[model samples]
Target: METKQTDIKLKTPIRCIVKLGGAAITCKNEFEKINEANLITVSSQLREAMMFGSSSGSVLEMDWSKRPGMAESLVKVDDYKEQLVLDFSSFVVIHGAGSFGHFQASTSGVHRGGLNQPLVKAGFVATRISVTSLNLEIVRALAREGIPSVAMSPFSCGWSTRERNIASADVSAVVEALDSGFVPVLHGDAVLDEALGCTILSGDVIISHLAAHLKPQFVVFLTDVFGVYDRPPAEPNAVLLREIAVREDGSWSVVNPTLEDSDKQVEISVASHDTTGGMVTKISEAAMIAKHGIDVYIVKAATEHSLTALSGKLRDKIPDDWLGTVIRHVS
Candidate 1:
């Protein structure tokens, strides 16, 4: 006589949110095109991070001759896909639109507020199509890797104010998907606004809201550069900031505050098409989440294994050498 298998229940797994920056996943200079090779590598990193639970996992090695973008670097990716004994409990993936939606958003001024003119409204529709295409591509890539990833649109259940900030959102579907063991993949999108006709909702802002609600153990922002820098990484003397710590009152320490006013904000670059606030906005948002007592990591994803490092697979992974930055709150 066999016992009923239905009686068994699984406990909730630890949850995490990972955002793949548009520039990291796609060539921001290119129009509506994804960096297929880079996408493959990043997606594989995500899978490997979830599959292996320890430092013994394989490392991704770089092969520069394969592609000009990832050239001149070797990376370590965990090679034990078959031998991994652990599994990721839960994951929420949010990705920026890069050239896809940014092109339309900036032209239409959607990020500023809403669609007032007919031309701007047309651009809104165009932006939606572009981002949706990219989102699907990401979902399909994860699916092929055997991760049950589901594409979710903020446009369907998200809301914003006339000032172009997220007001309220019905993320029940997202929560439901995660509870059901599906990796919900969300992308920055142009959504309906209460006062403004419509506005562009950025992925960084979306992740913050999700972090508040879901209270994930960690949040990872995978960007093009090596985390937060004292100055733009291109500058001759720019330095990478390893961590940003939050104070008891929720204030954050500005990294190498170089501005005249002593503002902690660091200067960051945005592609011409980008309507979102770019690097500065990303750091601000991550800091906000950190204030809520959640740990956030900003790292370079295109040419590094920062994802695995954040996943805590390697016990001795150095933030500076790994090109990763940590954001946290402390009393």
Candidate 2:
């Protein structure tokens, strides 16, 4: 009997998991409206970021070219690359619902989950339509940038929860997709709940869960503001927190913003129309993920710093001049 080696991931050493914040890509104040400029800009940046990656611990590239139906004229080559054009496969993109589903979810009380209510059930359907529509648009944007990507919604992917907390979820398909040279794009969705019938699963929670499972070298959050702030980003006294450290106990503290920055506070507020827990929930979830030794960086989308982050250049020490927030676990 002869044994042949056949185990190789599409791209080993996944560099980063990137999350596109709802506020960064959509018009939060306008219902169901997408910020086209932001979406296209980020999509281009992603194309650049994913163009270069190591050829896996083993070989990970399968290159071929054809001219429309000229089967006999096709050309194929295995470049034997130590560095190759396969990094995009290492990226897993997840996004949130800004003005898309939030209005419907909040108005219909979808996240509250009452299967008994006619309105709640109807809201569940409406909410998914909104978010999934956004998902499709995002996929299209990436495709336009020459990215091979697909939309994988939690609802359709066997994701369910118990009392709004993720209970039984599956990532097998995600792993399969990544290993096949395709970028799997996921989003916050409305999912079934054993206790609540159906509820909203925010992108914040989804990204944190992905971080735990995928164990990327780092996580990047593309946001509308500079980074995590002491208060709502629009507030007059808001101050960006450059660094945060998670303790072993799962609690976190500001590693930057010294005593003189006391004027800035840490109080967070949920938006009036948001069914999800807003920035407060984002910080809490980020802290939880950071406790596991994975660092998370939050930066403004479409800026030079964001381009650097998307390119995986901020994996280690973030530049002192870059305006972003980093969450790391500290012993």
Q: Work out the TM-score per prediction.
A: 0.81, 0.85
lDDT of 2 by residue, 19-138 (tens): 899999999999889999999899878877887653124332222333356775332233333334444548999999998999999999999999789999999999999999999889
Query: Can you tell me which runs of candidate 1 are displaced by over 4 Å?
Result: 1-14, 52-87, 114-116, 254-263, 313-320
| Model 1 agreement with the true structure over 157-229: per-residue lDDT tens digits | 5555445777667667776787677789999999877777788888999898778767777888998887888
Model 1 scores a C-alpha lDDT of 0.74
Clashing pairs in 2: none
Q: Pick the candidate with the highest lDDT.
A: 2
**Least accurate 10 contiguous residues by lDDT in model 2:** 1-10
The lDDT per prediction is 0.74, 0.82
